[model samples]
Target chain A: MKKHPLDDYLRVARMPHIWCPGCGLGLVVNCFLRGLLRSQLNLDKVVIVSGIGCTGRAAGYINLDSFHTTHGRAVPFATGLKVANPELEVVVISGDGDLVAIGGNHLIHAARRNTDLTVLCVNNFVYGMTGGQMGPTTPLTARTTTSRGGSVDRPFNIPHLAAASGAAYVARWTTAHVRRLEKAVTEALLKKGFSLVEIVSPCPTYYGRMNKQVTGLDQMKYFRDNSVIKSGIDPKGVGIEVNGPIVVGKFIDRG
Target chain B: MPEREYLAGEFFLSGDDACAEGAISAGCRFFAGYPITPATEIAERMSERLPEVGGNYIQMEDELGSMAAVLGASWAGTKAMTATSGPGFSLMMENIGLGIMTETPCVVVNIQRGGPSTGLPTLTGQGDMMQARWGSHGPYSIIALSPSSPQELYDLTIRAFNLSEKYRLPVLVMSEAATGHMYEKVVIPPSGEIELLARRKPTVPPEAYLPFAPDTDLVPPMANAGEGYRLHVTGLTHDERGYPAMTVEAQDRLVRRLVDKIERNKADIIALEEDGTGDAEVVICSYGVSARVSQIAVERARGEGIRVGLLRLITVWPFPDDRVRELARQVKAFVVPEINYGQIALEVERCACGLAKVVLVPHMGGRVHAPELILEAVRQAAR
Candidate 1:
């Protein structure tokens, strides 16, 4: 394991991150840095905004100009940020609950308007930050604290949600698929229009304890074993198997 | 229309139109709003008139969207504003906090109507006087004014822009149905020649420009979006670098700066008008539409040889307390007139404390206070 580079812009006072060992948020953050450093983009010229959740805490940890706005309103706040300063690259990192449920209008509108931004939605299938509530992205039949008797409602296939909202780049990756996720982030950052990459992350304490799934390590292995990387397949058909292959790849690239 | 000149280049216009025309003259590139009674005409005039100036006018989804778009335009370095009545004013609160915490400079005009909730949309009221001060959840300070006539509306709207640019905070013009709807002679503020407050440019190089960094005078030099400055603005409690920090030490310092800048400078921020206070037995305090009626009542009471004075609060947020207390010392009673039951009057009482007996002249709904109604309150207070 090589040492990661550090910068003054990044806050170290709040780290080492509170996420349990084997959590994928660290990978997302590292991949974000790699994507940031990969391009000669002005480090000062980029904004990373987050909402209130596990992923929402990313704003405090990042090494750039960032904001931790009110719940569900980060999209609009980020919208203001991008509109007010169109030159700065704005990226929104939100949990599924933060964006899909509360800040839903902001998500659809930013997509419909095709504002230049990157929306990184970490879908842990449950509200991991809030003690495992039933979220909009919670899978059907999945066990959560709120959905004790095997959940009835279906979860949103977020990549397709982005595609439907007219996003330019839409990709999906699980925590175990860090390399592909990194590439996806790079492409989303480089693209000119609204881009969203939905990362299927693990919630070891909440989601893991409730569901019969193994620990975070075993969960990562399970995701690696289960997800099918297809050159061409429907993203909607991916997760709920017996529904179809849990497809992982670039599902849509209008650019 | 060609620029009309009066005492020079000033032409007579209504308070509502004066505001709309002031906005156009200020190089305002965008106006987005919903039409509520009393304040609707400001939006109406802007819609018909903004296009002539090659600007944009949009009837937004709601007051929230109207406020949002105004913020959007400000980020583009375009001067922008919106107009609404009381209910719509309530709807705009959450985003107003957004504007403050983000420190986006723009104007928000609330043509105050009677209300706890939707009391009187067509009538005059200063009920939201305190709401404008404490409406948003966190700590903040605001600049709000109550214009008595069309001329003041025109002059004060320009002042709103200047104050907003100088302090980098949202400034609100609190007009009411009486002023916004009534016709009066007004000379529009000169635009092409008058000093326009241009958007502040980044002083530090683009890389070093912290969007919320305070330099001197407590205001950070701002950068517009296209000028190559990368800014990340948020409504959260942030440090000097505009990065969010939730620590007690950080929050205390941040909140103090937000409150102190306005509190320490209230003398400069506050403005008011006093009429006939020399050796008067009763002093009347009022604002917005009620002040107009109070003006006539004060004169009528004086014509009857009653020793009466009037204090018209132009800047309502800071509440002309110092002037009122000074008047309270010589006067036996302080009278307050408002379309609301007693909103600004309560503020007057707070300021007056026990300096003098306080009198209230209250009106609500679409009803306007006549000289007789307020004069009666004046006569009773004098006794």
Candidate 2:
């Protein structure tokens, strides 16, 4: 495979990147850059912030003034950056655990502020960094480090959470839908007020096993098979059911 | 002072009234805050006034939310601030460190009330002075100012924003609740006198900028978020590039520079008013309301034929040790008075370093230090 033409974030290009190959976070990152590139938004004004998780690696990877902050605190941190200097385009990238769990308070409040910033939540279902632990967005019936009996609690409908919390633009997509994710990201970035884009990424190393899926390719296939595309319609209109295509597209554009 | 017909603009006012208005005059376009006592007026004022000035004013869910939102606002390229009292100041401490580490310029105002924990909600006390300087959880530099009246509150509020922007650090306006709530004759500087502070923006085009690269000026020029510079800011120990660098050498250099920037530039940051130190045996030190009371007390003590002088600290953090030591040498004793049970007094003694006798005149929780009490302490120190 050719290098994707994305700029190497001058700081951390020479890794052994800590992320697993089957992980979809890198693709989400590329999509994010593409969105930035598409908008012709100046890189100097772009601030990429993240909480601790596989997604948090966005801080080190993106050639921007990245803030790799405390777990789940990216929203508030970014909120500070945005409010302090409203000219910067602040993008908060985080994982399921970082956003929905520990940073829940900041997330809702950022939405409440309608603070003209973008939050891209890379939902890999479970915690991928410290070995697969059950995450806030993981399916209740799935097995993991914290919930071996399967997560008994229901997951957050992030699109709903974003909308009800007052995000002007809200969207959900998968790594399989790269163009769609990129476009949604563009729209969210262009939208005024708080914007959120949840990318249903594959963590083949962690979440794949408990869900009985095997490889990164298989996870992409699962999303491809399960997601039904709906343009210009309410995501609430679609139902999450067994053996059904997961609805993937723009859900609300209050802006 | 040259008489000038300046921005004599008019607006309706509140105690929180003039502050938000003053913020705009100081070029504050972003205000992120949570509602809390005596300080709530600033938030209320910002919410109502900012919109009119085509600025952003957001009421965050809590003080922490308020602090974070404003930091984000600053990073996005606006002069920003947040106001709160004791507890909120505590919540804002963590992010205050982030702002310091990131070198984000902004302001925070702690309109103080009596407290160990929510001790007095709507009363005045200058107890939070020391906390304003050492509240955050790291080795970072701070600049905190105290005002005795509303006009100084108005003027210093603007100055706080200016200094924060000028230095690329968060400054504090440590307003006691009494000063914040007091109605005073504030001469809202004509537009010309009201100096506005914008971040020292990068003149370089986007591609060549290194966000944290230090210039000859000590503080680096900052670029706003979305400006395409691709800058990075982290709380972790990092290099000048602003990435999280966790190594022995990296930590050593980063911490040293953070401390050095403020330490080396202490002369530019410290400000104080020395009242009658020309011929004195007893020199009294105070700030905020205590300073106001001390000023009168020093006058009365002089009338009683005591050789007393006053050192009123305008900038409390950076501790003003050099001046304290200088004054201590010239006096037989240093009588330090404050609302807290000796926060600044202890500092005065440390700086005095036995050059003079250090005496603390303390008043705890919701009470003000009387001039007579401070005078008595000064007399005792002389004897």
Candidate 3:
């Protein structure tokens, strides 16, 4: 039986993963795998850790030494792996809710330590795994299962948070920008300390249905039409808005 | 790799310092911990010492991070340890359960201080004994040790690491604040004299490796993270392949293996020191700091012509049930003195099974029990 090129890098038996239709996690995972392959890292020495979420399932699907840890705990667990075995490369791929909402303290502290880790955070703008609820990166005025009346809560500007907390590299892209997202992930993987690439993914299943009945195609069209690349922009000023241009680019690369 | 010395000659070290040295002797090369009272000295000593010996020491953001890191380091193929006090111990409960579920081998040192929440940080208390057994949510079993002196702290910490390696789970060193801060002469034996047990590594190739499959002894072999074993590890109930199996049958098999591993090895795991039990009517049962106090009280009782003996518990968890049950028939009464209100005393009473009168000499935290109070309890129990 012939194997697919990416088959070596995936858990084929665990195929048919528990993700929803129109979810962007699959595309993000594709980008991540391409980046890993391009980086030419020793696959044996690369470890992936994820907390609880749809993105957290990335660890379970990856054919690597992956840890599906408790909610909000992947950073600390990955920090441990890097500190203990400095020879290995550690990556944390989890959602904004798991990383910044409950696990926010760990994310900031790991950044402050300048720990050698590459974090690929998939921001779907809602808590996708636990039903579409308001998350740390949910855009203001976006409706969700929890925020039935448009959300009054201000969401985290993820890039700004990473840069302010001392990340060595920070970048943002949408799943629609697969080539750029993959390239950015490769760059982040090569960086030495606390690298982050935020992939603003779409969740047509919940976030879309709640907010304007936006389907997967509509979200993809929005990404294609509304995204504006602005490398080296002040991350603090690069916040997302409903029906506005999404500023996406490599904002910080201190290497 | 750099060559390093493992043994340091005899020195007057505190219990905490001795513990750090013991970790080094046991090949523990990774220490991740947060600074807390009583146990902070262990982390301080480790920070100064680990780098010199080609190991790493990290001061984590909190106890939760510390525990998580210890598990991570262990999976990365290093003997890892962390030291904390009451508040930090409480914070580590959630991840401790994770460690148990994943069958990660690491050492957690909880130098006991007074607490339900942050009570008497700089003082001694054994109130965490019950919490150590049932602190983490879910049905699971763990190995815990108590040390009465600085010398024992060194010896037992190495044993703690060995037991964790053997059992493929986290082993706890539950020392009191008094023991942690107390200074005594400790002899660091030559590296050859120390017995270090490495985790059983998988001999089978990556294709045939089952991360959670048990052997005859019911412990699965571990494969290091970078050993070409692209294994999946999760906190959710998992099968032998280490993949999540969300069923009652899967839960039963997984939880039973986790618990049965300890229960089947109870005799080998139980460690105690008994004296004068032969032809004695009154036996004084104690552990940790209370054991030292009870010794003094027992000797005083002997001077007063009472038949008193001491059964000091070195391994606290797994309860020494069979031994306690056996002593119940021979001894007339048992006096259990502890720094807590009455934690281990209840265990003694349950094992005594009404054949012997079990008296508790309780001390509310911040201090050890007075010898006279224990002596009085012994006298009353003897009567």
Candidate 4:
């Protein structure tokens, strides 16, 4: 019957969350909560909107004004909430497949409009919720359920895309870099006008296993070993390659 | 110029403009819409009017985003709406279903144009009647109202908001291109004189609140985003506590309540304008622009002593089945005229249930049905 420190910020009853073992989603949520606490935001005025995917369920676990919206629709839905009540802080947390694939148009348009929102994109490199299919963020040569031999198609460099589409703040961090990821989320939360923090998380049950990482810990180890911290680097040069060094940083910071 | 919250005077307005004014009067503080033909005027007027009244108007990327935005605003405890036509209406179907499943209150105005696929952009079409009822791909009921004139459009736009707030679901204002484009005198009443219904707010404290727990009226009291209540809303089949429940029993309970909230409350939801149907041998059933055309035909048939009458549908969704059935028992035949081939006529046929003959006068869209065509149908039905 021990009370958890974060219980006040979470829906404890809805606990034993639906996330799988060694899933980075929990880590991402932890970082987000830490960032939320650090930002000193009025919890009463924050609303979270998410689209359909494994990451979409994050809305339900948080004890705030949360909306689990339709597929690829969180950005637009959050846009509506923010525009209607400018006093309320709106954040969108959804997976890469939800935000960059079907919702790509909304993502770019929101950034173009410079709407005030913080978007936390959990990029597991594949569609983990619907089985490991090739997604827009899947690195080149990444194997998924659909990409049997290898993903022949080029993947999107999300930070580059966000920055190009007029995002005022764009950054990327992996689940292994929990402290940096938390700090990035905090900065994104406080920043105005279309901020995006891309969390390169692991999907051990699907994407990780398919890519030979075998376990979530292995993926975390890979991220820790391979990711190079490049502050203020150009987003265009930060695209991930197959087993290549990952360049992670805050790429865009414009008012 | 100073901002004016109420235009309390008579002015010439198109149906689309009147609808925007009506929404403003009805306390709709948030509007999100995409520009589409015929219905574009509503969004334009809203964009100009909303900021004047301390409200927000967002021109979303497309109708899908518009609909989604409307739902989001409603959750924030704002009266919200969106307007679109055929192609845009098709794009809104997914979020429309979300509105239904999440029991969110908002209004959608579909100033219908011709379409199997973008059939007519500038011309009139009543082809989206059935689509309004069943377009969202679900087993839930909907509330739809049809207006034949700018005055009715204004009045019903307010009613659409009221009904949506009362039922906690999306309400459709089904206007056609003819009504949308037509200019007519619209009387804008003072703000205090207009009756507006706000969403029911929860009575209990946040600790004891259940987001989907219905009261006696089957509508849960709503709490806005900034309120102390931490609400979790989703489109999935959820329990009364608003947690996703992936069980068959959960789906049945939730779907049934979503449907029965409107079905069981039909008497309060359905509205009809019955004119001269008491002792007529032939009753012409119609709605939207076709209703006005049917009225002229009825007047003509009455002049010719054919004993024809008109039943103008103000609320089209619940279908006024009881009244239609009662009239069917006394009438020899019923003539249904609509811009589309045969949408509401099929409803009439079902309600009539072999008690009377049903005649359908169909038009394929781009233009309203000529009075002569409806008169001809009425004359044949009177025989």
DockQ numbers for every candidate?
0.27, 0.54, 0.83, 0.84
Cα lDDT tens digits, model 1, B187-223, are 6533556567876677788667777777566777887
Give per-residue CA lDDT, model 2, range B54-120, as digits (tens).
6778777777667777777777777889889999999888778877887878889888998889899
lDDT of 2 by residue, A1-255 (tens): 455577564344435566887889778888988888898876667788888888987888777777787667788878777665666787899997999898888898788878898999998888899999987777757777788887887777787787888888888899999998999888888888999998998988877876777789888999998887775576555433322367878878883
Model 3 Cα lDDT, one tens digit per residue, B49-78: 899888899998998888988889998899
Scored by DockQ, the top model is 4
**Among all candidates shown, the one with the greatest lDDT:** 4
lDDT of 4 at A150: 93
Docking class of 2: medium
> What's the C-alpha lDDT at position B304 in model 1?
89
| CA lDDT of every candidate | 0.77, 0.79, 0.92, 0.92
Report model 3's TM-score to 2 decimal places: 0.98
DockQ of 4: 0.84
Query: Could you list the chain B TM-scores for each candidate?
Result: 0.92, 0.94, 0.98, 0.98
| Candidate 4 residue spans exceeding 4 A from truth | B1-3
How many backbone clashes can be found in candidate 4? 0
True contacts kept of each: 0.23, 0.74, 0.77, 0.78
Q: List the candidates ranked by DockQ, beginning with the highest.
A: 4, 3, 2, 1
> Is model 3 an incorrect, acceptable, medium or high docking prediction?
high
- What are the candidates' C-alpha RMSDs? 4.1, 4.0, 1.5, 1.2
Worst 10 residues of 4 chain B by lDDT: B1-10
